[model samples]
Target: MIHTVRSGETLFSIAQRYNIDPNNLARINNITNPNEITVGQNLFIPLSRITSYQIKNGDTLYSIARANGILLNDLITANPQISNPNMLNVGDTINIPDVRKEIEINGYAIPSINQSILNDTLEYLTYLSPFSYQVNMDGSLSQLNDETLISSARNSGVAPIMVVTNISSEGGFDGEIAHKVFTDVTTKQSLINAIKSIVIDKNYSGVDIDFEYLLPEDRDNYTAFLRELKTELEGINKTLSVAVAPKNRDNMAGSLYQAHDYKAIGEIADRVIIMTYEWGYIYGEPQAISPYNQVDKVIAYAVTQIPSQKILMGMPNYAYDWVIPYVQGTSAKTLTNRQALRLAYENNATIMFDTLSKAPYFSYSDSDGREHVVWFDDALSIGSRLDIVTKYNLGGLSYWTINNFDSANWAIVSDTFRIKKVM
Candidate 1:
């Protein structure tokens, strides 16, 4: 079990709510100053079904266990720290362990989602990151009515990570805008200040910086910005997560993929979310959204740079349908994972998985005699990808967007792994 701090909640109050000792709570989470916890911070309870119970003035291990419907032996075993239960301090916190390790699950959400969707999906997330707060050159941010998502996530025991991106409201990621903020000292500080203000005002547990298509010249500047933000957020116990495009090599050159400097980012940010998807994209050739071979290669190189424990492999929750005889400038249409399956069924298309890519894809001709190819991830493919997490000892999985409810994906994910909760 984990607990997310809410407004006006202090370490003592949270400890009492969970029936844990304040000292134990603080100790487990490395809270040097128990009073310094901010709203939205995730506190790992280190317990699952069993809540921690504080020893009262007249409490005995037997009495405590009996009262909580636990066996005395189990209680004693779980609270080994209490060598002499009879002489326990009034506020001694004891663990009641029926524990199962839960993997962290981070999902990205957009502002347009309704309350119903939020309610339905919060249970499956460890963190719900809003799609973005677009940054302006002057360090200003686009406002969003994200209160609903934040409140719902907090209520559901899921931490909300505010996503700050370099994308322009008018369109996609702007390289010039990224360059301006990264290279201009004044604008960069202003952007950091703006991000900090929004984080505080929104009670965000952390910030996910997704600056893409950066100019190679701004690489050092980008690292510096992350370091500063990490230090600032660290002072207040807030987290910093950075999202980088997939690359198989450190020196791989491209505007979109370069300048990420994964090693530097991994050293600074608390989490480095590697977007391992998009081999098949809106404007790309028909292929698996995340080709296993590519993703594996990316992971192999990333682990050599960043600590595997800090990496959250990014997975695409959607698919793409591309027109055959692929034209240079033509873009493929998008679809949800379920939608892709429905299309395959309607067309009687025989699905096949590429051995090299380890992605499932198929082809069919439309009424207009136009050939199309569909590549997407289903339960089987998703499961295989998730297996890589355990294989690589990575932090967890980060879904690019969880707006569409793919029950198959969720079901398989849940069945395969338990999710950590901070409520």
Candidate 2:
């Protein structure tokens, strides 16, 4: 439980009231100076069922849970309630319950796989890319990795999805390539045949079509392609999902937004994953990564076009730390959510939450004496986003990429709701 600090409340007094160690409270809250407590700042107090665990050599929560016969989520849910689950100490005695059952937690795995990283995540969805598939001029396709990752995911009870992209080797999503494959009669047939072959050959459970940058004129063609894909997939008892740009209205402007045709896509696809996180990014102006206002706007319009149960809200697990005296063309440095918080702590900077945006940011200086502003997600920010899921009664959330696991996110999610698992 979180306790909001009041005026003149000492750490010792608060700890005594809660029956917890003052030092432990300070350390868990990342407070070096226990005497200095800010008014209105929320402090997480460890409860009886929520405690810390110390890691032993060659120890994993999976093995521990298996031996203890407790589900990983139960073990995680019983912990001291720290934001990041990945931030565990070697000798801490974490909270544990007596049981053996797994909770369903879905996560998106990008086409790029780092096995070590994948093994550490608690996601149930593994999205494989057709972009990585070798497509021949004759319209036949070749498999990559011999389906090594796909097999691994299935064995682990994670569903493998085929992710189709409109990207060309040059860079970015190419409209011409999309038009050629999606609109052109022969190419469209070839693409469909290739998709069918992959689904059958690889035993894929679903398909995620992520075609972007199509011309507005090709909107019908895009929709047509999705309808055909869905029809074929449904015949085989497989699912069809799409990744779309966040739109504020039916006629939201821009080629990216306009061509999406949310209403049409919703009718054809099983689930639509909204790409909602890039407002503050590498090439864009400095801003909140997933500002609450912007996200709400997208969700507000999306519900009107699609069924709320089929909308998967997008959440970013990273942040951008931009250097001061912003250059118009230079890129911003990317930092994980945990790294952002650690940077603030190391710099003795206070983290600020924007009331309007419902986002967390911190300003700090680097070793080179360069001032920087970081806009990232934290437990508080993530909690606010997850509220949208509950408010909209949406299907679930889809992480853009879980390559960088944030323990805080998992903790907050575990506290909020049970993740849905298809497998």
Which whole-number lDDT from 0 to 100 does residue 23 have in model 2?
Answer: 90
- State the TM-score for model 1: 0.76
lDDT tens readout by residue for model 2, 334-390: 988666766765676676779888887778888899889989876677778888887
Could you tell me how far off, in angstroms, the CA of residue 74 lies in candidate 2 after the best superposition? 22
Worst 10 residues of 2 by lDDT: 98-107
Candidate topping lDDT: 1
* Residue 328's lDDT in candidate 1: 81
- lDDT, residue 312, model 2: 85
**In model 1, what are the clashing residue pairs, if there are any?**
1-47, 19-52, 21-93
Q: Give the TM-score of candidate 2.
A: 0.76
List runs of model 1 lying over 4 Å from the truth.
1-101
